[model samples]
Target chain A: MVVSVAHLGPPGTYAEAAALAYVNWLNQRGQQGLLCPCPSIAQTLRAAAQGQADVAVVPVENSVEGSVTTTLDTLWQLDKLQIQQAHVLPISHALLSRAETLEEIKTVYSHPQALAQCQGWLERFLPSVQLVPMNATTEALKYLGEDKTAAAIASSRAAQLYHLPILVCPINDYPDNYTRFWVLSLQPSGGGSHTSLAFSVPANVPGALVKPLEVFASRGINLSRIESRPTKRSLGDYLFFTDLEADAREASVQSALKELTAYTETLKIFGSYSIVSIGKL
Target chain B: MVVSVAHLGPPGTYAEAAALAYVNWLNQRGQQGLLCPCPSIAQTLRAAAQGQADVAVVPVENSVEGSVTTTLDTLWQLDKLQIQQAHVLPISHALLSRAETLEEIKTVYSHPQALAQCQGWLERFLPSVQLVPMNATTEALKYLGEDKTAAAIASSRAAQLYHLPILVCPINDYPDNYTRFWVLSLQPSGGGSHTSLAFSVPANVPGALVKPLEVFASRGINLSRIESRPTKRSLGDYLFFTDLEADAREASVQSALKELTAYTETLKIFGSYSIVSIGKL
Candidate 1:
């Protein structure tokens, strides 16, 4: 059986690399999978939701940059899609272009994150060049082949694949850049050993968040991470997303979940997933 | 007293608007203040740090978008500056250009947040147009005036200020979009009614964050907001920035701060500020 994976693409992106890594793990277990690239993270999730792909692997967090809000917001909007597994990838960006000199480059295109990561370098070297945003990092490389004056900030793999000159290597401000990606599927796998979930506290309650969080703390369940998004209804109201070390189906976690509802206005389990730590490439 | 306000600028951006609003408030209090337009938020903060400006007013959060991460990161890095006041301003983005129609807008320029907020509209109408990132939303207006085919997503004020045609009146996806800004000063204001601060919990301590949060909960102090940034020293380690309803000068809040240190490895008080709520314009 083939397990088709979807990710934001044109192939040499970090998202595509993550999908490949997940496919590689599946192959070790005697399963075969191929990647299907989509134009955006929204489209990548849609491919899985629409049954065009078995799962979609998309970056949800960056160590230096914090949460990938697009992926998080998309997952929150499409409530049914569940995280089947999570993966960590070390990231390094390269400046790719066909120009013989930096002076010849008039425009640089990349994902906003990439541009932000290398902003200092751009300011110092090409202060006047235009920085354009593309849907994805590797997708930005497409513009490089068409215009000699256009450059892209993407993975080293993109430079190799696209046959573009490596204008600069390791363009990111931080050498410790790493991103976490989640394998999302339409149907719950119901097997992984960890859980991802989101909840919103009762607005205006003094200890609204603390009560729901206590449910996990009392049970000795440690939380891996927590993120908050404004509720948009008012200034202080928010929706909290968290990842816990315990699975939703576990007896202890199950009881914690039951008590959690008393403090939270909304609770959603994005489902269980084992963490695959492939540290650095 | 001469109040110098620092903000990101080329004149027509929201940050400039924030600085102007702050200056206006100071004027109402029978004081004169001048706006100091900097090239970037980092520079704006630097202007205050070096005493070139009396204070810096920068966006901290948006209603639709979560955090203004650049401002957050800059605040974390420059630990000396303290929040003197907080202000909320309703946001509305407009498409500015010399182009007669959307079809003629071959390139769209904006601050990344503006572009993201208008992503749906851009995708629906000008799917194939190039998106360029500028340092500020107002900074993008510079490109619009120079290139007739270039369009910018900025405040309606930019249209009048730059004499550019308004291609679209309200380009943002959400009409209720608003941004929260903080006035930063070198020393504590001592007058504001509330406080903003950041702390890092010791790694590997189970419920480390819970213990510190409980201090506020036990004191009945309401937290207005909380944001976490990866500590970068290790995995799952994060520095949490939080805004609470009590000031450091208050006896209850002072004791809570003392109790917080027991559960945290590093703590920094970003100082007290009063809340200023200015609803949609």
Candidate 2:
């Protein structure tokens, strides 16, 4: 029997590295895992939903960047898929190129997030070079194959995969840059100390959000995050995505959620998930 | 005296339109206003800070998409800039091109935000067309002159400025899409009813944010928005940006802020300003 994990990829992206890391973790637990690379975060979610992959790994939030909207929006839109586990990967970007010298580079390309992470570095070191953002950082590897003048900001794993030379390691502006990826599966894996959920409240009511949060605070459920995304209906109307320290199986948590559901116009549990702190593979 | 307004531009962007609208508003008040086109949001803000422009108008939020991080980050970095006024404009994207028909478009270009806003439309109408994201939607205006196969998702104003035909109107996924732009100036504008502020609380303390809100609630001050971004120090650390219904000069708001500043490690008052809403020109 084989287990398949889907992730955003052209084979060398951080998402792909995360998928490899998950596979490594699964292997330690006596499971044989196969990696399935998808083009977009939306497709990565769909791969798991459609059973092309048993699970999907997609970035949820970044320590530096905040929420990954593509992942968050897709998770919200796809009602059936549930988060099985959460993984934190320290994002250490590198300047990858075929060129021997930085002065020879005319264009630098990577994922927009990657480009943004290295904005300060690119500005300081390669001020005159063009910055092009692609779908995935791995896609930048392809551009450098023919153009010696082109460089890319990507993971060391991307450099290794594409057989490119690393001009500079850890090109990210902040050393503390880290990304949290959520492992998603069609069914709930269960047995997790943490639970993630989203809910929307009536817009017109003042202190509408405070009430639902009070339900958690009253239960002493420590919330790790509370991110508000626009409902797309109007300005100021939002859907709050929250992370709690307890799973639905806990009686106190269940009661709090019941009270929360009553207060919210819409509520969703993204399933219980444990955090996996792993280094990039 | 000519008062200059700076905005993000290639000349046909929403930001440029907002600048023109602001100039119109200023002209109505009998002030001679000059339009200044900037290459980026950072440049636009810098223009005001360096006295290159009297004020700068840049998009801060979208109704459907939410906060503009570039605007938020730049504002946070430039502590001297103050909000003169907030402007909300209806965002209606159109498919603009030299091509007579949608079928003739082999590639679609837009700003990443614009692309995301029209994702559903592009997927439905031109599924296989290559989607390219540029710095501004207006940059796509130049591409049409060279490539008959290229189309851009931008405003009707952009289409007119570029002398291109609108292939599709209101291509955005949501009709409720509106962008809120902030008019920024070096000097604080006095006597506005609305205020915007940001603060960061100690990470170790649970319910730290709750105390700051309680200050507002206790004073009966209405908060319109609360957005949290990563502090970039570590995971779970955040800086909260908030919007209030009352100006800092108001007795109630001042008292609440005084209490809020004491509770948080860092607090910044972005100044009090009223909102000026105008339809997209």
Candidate 3:
């Protein structure tokens, strides 16, 4: 089967890295055809909605940065695309430059999130230089290749692809920086190891979260992640995106979902698929 | 009293805007003095520890985006600067331009967070334009002044200061977009109306969070916010930062803290201060 993958940039981005990893995983299993790259998460989901792509991959959360709200907001808007799978990729940043020395670098460039993640390191090491920002770290790398006095904070893979030398390695403030990505698709697959879904409940209801959680607890199912996003439509309303460590077919899992639908204002099971490791990508 | 402000820029940034707002608030209260504008949160805390400033203001969380991890991480490290006060500022973004029309705008610039916050609007309005990321929204305005085809996503204040016309007003995706700021001080003030603190519990320990939460619940004190950050030193250890409605001096609040400390392995009161409204600024 063919799949369309949507990431953050043209190429050589962490999102692209994650998407490629998924592509390689599918290819190895002899089950892939096309992987289309999109510029933003909204565009990715739009492509899936229009049937231009079968599936899209987007970053959901970063260990150091918490959550990617763009993806969350887009997911909230799109009703067709369901979260089918997930993968966590370790992120290591590097300061890349065309010039040889820090003295030659007058300006540094990177995505704002990348810059923020490395804020402490940049201040301590490169205090006098000006920081220039770009939409994606890959674009920063591109600018670095063209400008002699500018450096870019990007992944090691980007530096290699762009032929920029690494001025500083692992520039992120946290050593264990990781990004969690979700795979979205229109068709729901069965016989998967787990399922991911997003739902919402009435706000300010003291025990609202507990009742849905009890469904899993009663059946002895494990929950991988649970996050809340404000609906923006109202002050108190919240949409909860959750991941469970079991397929929908499981008796307890089905029972939990059946009970959850009655209580929650809205519940949607995005999709079910096998979980894959980064190394497997 | 002198204050230290930690912001996200070298000189001109939206962080600077927020910092200036805090400085103006203090100055208006007849406490006019120099405010040390540090480039990073860590530096701000370091300044506080070194007794360079009496208080520091840092952005803790944003409504549309969620928590600012750097501020949270730096707070976890310093153990000196405590939350003295909290304020929520409404964020209104403007598209600052040196050129008049969208056709002349070759590149759009802003902080990565600002860009992400306006991703929906940007994608729909400017699909083909290049997005230049900068350290702060203010710096993006600087770029716009220099580049004829560039427009910057910045606050209305920046546009007014730079004499750049606003192409689009309130371009952010959400109307309720606001940022939560914390005024941290070296010493706790006796007349505070609210309290903020940080603590941690072992991961996967069932009801570990609930036990500490019960302390405040039993006292009928409302929690304003609760966020989790991974403790870098340990794999599963998480540091939880919480804000409560009542001041630490309150009898019930004090009793709750005493009870909480007993159940918690690590608990620290960060600060006690009155809540400030956005209108007050």
Q: How are the candidates ranked when ordered by lDDT, highest leading?
A: 2, 1, 3
- How far residue A122's Cα lies from its native spot in candidate 2, in Å, is 1.3
A1-281, model 1: which lDDT tens digit per residue? 99999998878999999999999999999999988998788889978988889999999988877888878777877788988888989888888988888899999998878887788789899899987766678777778765778899999988888888898888887788888899999887665767888988877656777887788998899888888887666556688888888878889998999999888888888998888988653
Instruction: Point to the candidate with the largest DockQ.
Output: 2
lDDT by residue (tens digit), candidate 2, B1-281: 88899999878899988888888888899989888898778889988989988999999889888889878877887888999998888889999887887888899888889999998888899988988778789887777885779998989988887788998898899998889999989886775878999888866344666778778866777778888888878888888898888888988887788777778998988999998889652
Cα-based lDDT for every prediction: 0.84, 0.85, 0.73
What's the residue-level lDDT of B195 in candidate 1?
Answer: 86
- Winner on TM-score (1 vs 3): 1
Q: What's the TM-score, to 2 decimals, of chain B in model 1? A: 0.94
lDDT of 2 at A262: 78
Clashing residue pairs in candidate 1 are: none
Per-residue lDDT of candidate 3, residues A8-97 (tens digit): 676788988888888887889887746676766678778877788777888877776666777877777777776677787888899898
| Model 3, residue pairs in steric clash | A133-B133, A133-B134, A134-B133
Give the interface RMSD of each candidate. Answer: 1.9, 1.5, 3.8
Error of 2 at B262 (Å): 2.9
lDDT of 1 by residue, B148-200 (tens): 78999998887888888887879787777889899998976755677888888
* TM-scores for every candidate against the unseen true structure: 0.92, 0.96, 0.86
